[model samples]
Target: MTQEKFEHIYQRAEERKGGETQLENLIYQPLSNDDLRCITDDRWLAGFTEKVFQCGISWNVVRKKWPNFEEVFFGFKIDSLMMLSDEMWEKKAQDPRIIRHLTKVMTIPANAMMIRSARQQHDSFSEMVAEWPSESITELWDYLKKHGKRLGGNTGAYALRQMGKDTFILSSDVESYLRQTGIIDSGRTTKRAQLAANKAFNQWQQESGRSLSEISQIIAYSCGDNRVL
Candidate 1:
């Protein structure tokens, strides 16, 4: 596949934005404990939980209420959140300050425990992330899908890319661009489709030398979104 087709679309996006664009500007900055003055567990928790809550909901709502979410989850400190009793989460489901999807709310603790477990073995969750294989990033996605709550499919991938992990997110637009460009079959988010997409990206990275983050953003930009919905 020609990278130029994707680049042409992104170039149009650049021109629409008054003739200048930066790939990093269009993507979320990756986070680290040292960079944000936060612990690795907390950092992972934040990205994980945010992706969970944003699923099937307007992302704008999640963005607006995230501060309250941070406060309620004790800045997403793993031990602090683990101490929250079931009754506490029940109360949070009724809290007005945040979206109260009970299942999603409960995932915070499950996810916290996941990071804590990783910390136990790796010294810090960020270290685990750092050591994760970038060349086979889909393996990281598979691990999250198996081990973490609400982390299946795009949610896990979304969290990784949002935290600046060297990964790709198969968001709707990204998938569409892939299909239209003759990279993968169209219809349903299936295992075969995921594997094919991963293979295509692996080849593209080899050919173009772009990070999966930038490549994924380029795919999204190829669909011509100049602004948020």
Candidate 2:
């Protein structure tokens, strides 16, 4: 869509609700080395693990247990997490402090190792993400799906957004809207669908001079009544 169409939709939402977009609250600045450093390693894993556990469950449930999650996770420190033994993992899978799903439980250390590997290569997970160009933010989604455990499709995108990467999250509302808008052809998440979605965001960003995060929110507002992550 053109910038005018985008603004018109967002303006209608603004008129109806009289509040700022979540993007405004997010204040997602253009990524840089400084932005990467602003979020430490522990915070990145915390965000990643939260999103991972939140994959198929009610968000409210996750929020409710988040304090206990942090406690069991030892504040998400990688060094401590990397050293957690298998027996501890199995015991924690049966623990009440966090969700007891073993698969999701295993992803914690697997992704910690993923981040550690990225840090060894680039200094930090946020830096690795920050260094990616805006023109191809979707590539990071693909990277995380391929490299990070239990982080495929929408999960990885949500993690990136939580970690403050400027990205377009294809929430249910946003994806449906994109399909209806002719940016995507079908509900199936084929490679072609992703390419089309990526193209549309790239075009919109070029036209509006807005970040992908901004464009995604505007698109959601344009088509749906409420924005979702």
Candidate 3:
């Protein structure tokens, strides 16, 4: 099915958000490839872990304790984390400086390894992320879901977005918009649904000359009960 032009969507978003300036202010632009390349693997692991911990929990709670998390996780240094034993990870889980969720705590080591593996194959984990083609972003998402622990569905997408990857998140509003538009007729996380969303976003990107990040936010702002001031 043919989707509505991105111009119409952007106009509705501008109207909902009070005007063009307000909507533009609300949209965050993704970093360029060079900027993305400079981000270290440790920071990438940290970003991923933050989103993993924030999943299904109050982001405020995670935000407040984030420094302590950095401290307890040894700044998320990939090599140091890789050297840690299971016993060390267990101690980390029990540490009062951060949340005591063992499952989430364990993602640190697993994701660290994922980054390390990427580093071995490419110049660095950041380079791999930077060089990944936007045309097949879902494939990168699939790689993370396959190779990293607890990074399936929106978790990996959120992490990638946080680390400046130009990928659209399948947020609730975006998913609803897709479903309403007949963009996908299956489960939101299914491969078919992701590819469909990707194609629509590509079309919108071509039409608007906006990054996926901006388009995703615009699509979100166009629908839903987002408050305007």
Candidate 4:
């Protein structure tokens, strides 16, 4: 891309600070306690709950079929998912309302089991996740790799962080924030973006003597959209 185009994209991103993007506001934002309750409600779980089953699918597709998925999956209740037999799986496998990938469909029940097991070991799911170690980046990564069996990888770790399960310095959005801030010149390769973002963030931390929260607000203000970058 031309320098002019890059600058334009950077500026657009900066303009988005405080303003909400569809992804940031509607989709990727962490769920509230009330939101979780609504999702897990008995009636909601009865027919509309398989939304989480689409973990590896593109978010766009998941969002599109979200209602249908709820209709088909009985609202994602652990019991509803647990009740799925091979016949039900086969039936839903052909359903157009959800991503029809068999392996992902199958993993829902397995994931439910894991969630239940975590609850059994701890008093609640949140408590269990809280017990997960978060002292170091390496430990955080390791914990994600081990327990996030359903979707745990770097991307999964990032998602978990967004969901408040873990705390880490790296996230895809943060990488975008760094690029928009002109902190590093590297373009979109994952490794390059990660390295650039991390270096920039560390530098910003030292130079401004600001907390991550404050820096994040600044970054968010500075780089709101990719159009400006």
Candidate 5:
């Protein structure tokens, strides 16, 4: 179907759920330090590292392994990651606590080095990212395809947005949430569900004057069939 036609269906679906809200209507809940740290890092290389490790695994699994990842990866410090020796790398690969994919495991140190090189040339990771134009969806897609090392794809791009790497929205879970909320009618192929979820979130923000955390709670309550909020 045509994009416009699809969008129309999505709008109809959204109307069935509850319709859209205004910009200032959302209730804002502050993000915790750990949560904020994911986005607010000077380079967001930590998120990149996490994405690298998350290859071929469910995010829930990666979430559980985050502590171990942090410890082994030097808190995702770019400089430290670049400094990892072959022995240290071998030890981390053998560690039972982390995902043990040999190729992905090896890519960590290599990508870290790449990140360092990029940073040296650009003076900052963010600067390197900034060089890519992220204004349009097409641009964002191209940029992601070009620069995303390892096995990351659209899903990874969405994760980067969630981690506050840039301001683009995408995620499968988020799209499911939006589909449930009746924001968008149809989902896109790549992270369409997540895009739908963010669309609903924007709408919720308009209607409730609440933050993402609050919206998350409400969505959870609604989805979980909680009678009492």
Candidate 6:
């Protein structure tokens, strides 16, 4: 199977979305490296926590409870999270202010340590994230998966997206498109599959001069039963 060019994908997405204008309006642009570097570490932690908790749960529920999450977690401040004792953590799991899942609640401190480690080594977690090259985005994914709790697979990718990182998501529609083009095989999270996806996205970026997020959106829009407006 031949891989389609970005132009073809964009054209189909535009048609599905009504027009170029409409399609562009719907695209979520990523932040520049400068802007990404300016985002505080607490925000990064918050993004990761949101995505982690959102896994296997209703995003709307999480969103509605986000203020409580911030309050209970102290805005996900790294120092505050690191200071949480075992008893405090247990109390957090049982607290009605946030979701009462112990396992998910435990990930907060672990991920906070992950962020702190990066900041300790690199001066700030934002600097590390902003300096990561988009061409090898899967490496960043791997780092988060290895170092952070429950941040593997789409969880980390979605968090990165939420934090304005330039990376592609393996959404169902994007996965279908990749499968049709033979870019990935059985599992999207496997090393081989991730590498293949990275290479393909790099090629697409070279050809189209678009961000990975834009390319991902176009691929998703092209293959799915998206509403035509």
lDDT of 1 by residue, 1-229 (tens): 6534445655665654445445446755444435533436787899999999999999999999999999877898887778778998899878889998899998888888777787668867777777776677777787788778999868998887777677888877887777777777754356677777778787777766777777777667656454433
Candidate 6 local lDDT, 71-129, one digit each (tens): 98898888878887899999988989888899998988888888888967797888999
Candidate 5 residue lDDT tens string, 86-191: 8778878888887776667776665555555655676554455544432333344444445555624555555445554333333454445555546566634444
Runs with alpha carbons beyond 4 Å of true place in candidate 1? 1-39, 186-188, 224-229
Q: Name the weakest run of 10 consecutive residues (lDDT summed) in model 3.
A: 220-229
TM-score of 3: 0.97
Ranking by TM-score: 3, 6, 2, 1, 5, 4
lDDT by residue (13-101, candidate 2, tens digit) is 45444456543563355455577667888887888889988988998899899899889878989999888899998887788878889
What value of lDDT does candidate 2 attain over all alpha carbons?
0.77
- Residues 1-229, model 3: lDDT tens digits: 6799999999899999999999999989899999999998889999999999999999999999999999988899987888888998999899998989999999899888888888678999889999998878999999999999999999999999988899999999999999999998899889999999999999998988889989999999999887586
Q: What is the lDDT of residue 19 in candidate 2?
A: 55
Number of clashing residue pairs, candidate 1: 0
Best by lDDT: 3
In order, the Cα lDDT scores of the candidates are: 0.75, 0.77, 0.92, 0.49, 0.52, 0.90
| Model 5 bad stretches (over 4 Å) | 1-10, 21-43, 136-148, 165-229
Per-residue C-alpha lDDT of model 4 across residues 1-229, encoded as one tens digit per residue: 2122333433444455434453134222333444433332233222212334444567677777777766776666777677778898888878976667776666556555555666566665555444553323335444434554444435444444445442334445555655555754665434454454445544555565543333444444444343322
Q: How far in Å is the alpha carbon of 124 misplaced in model 1?
A: 2.0
The 10-residue segment of model 4 with minimum total lDDT is 40-49
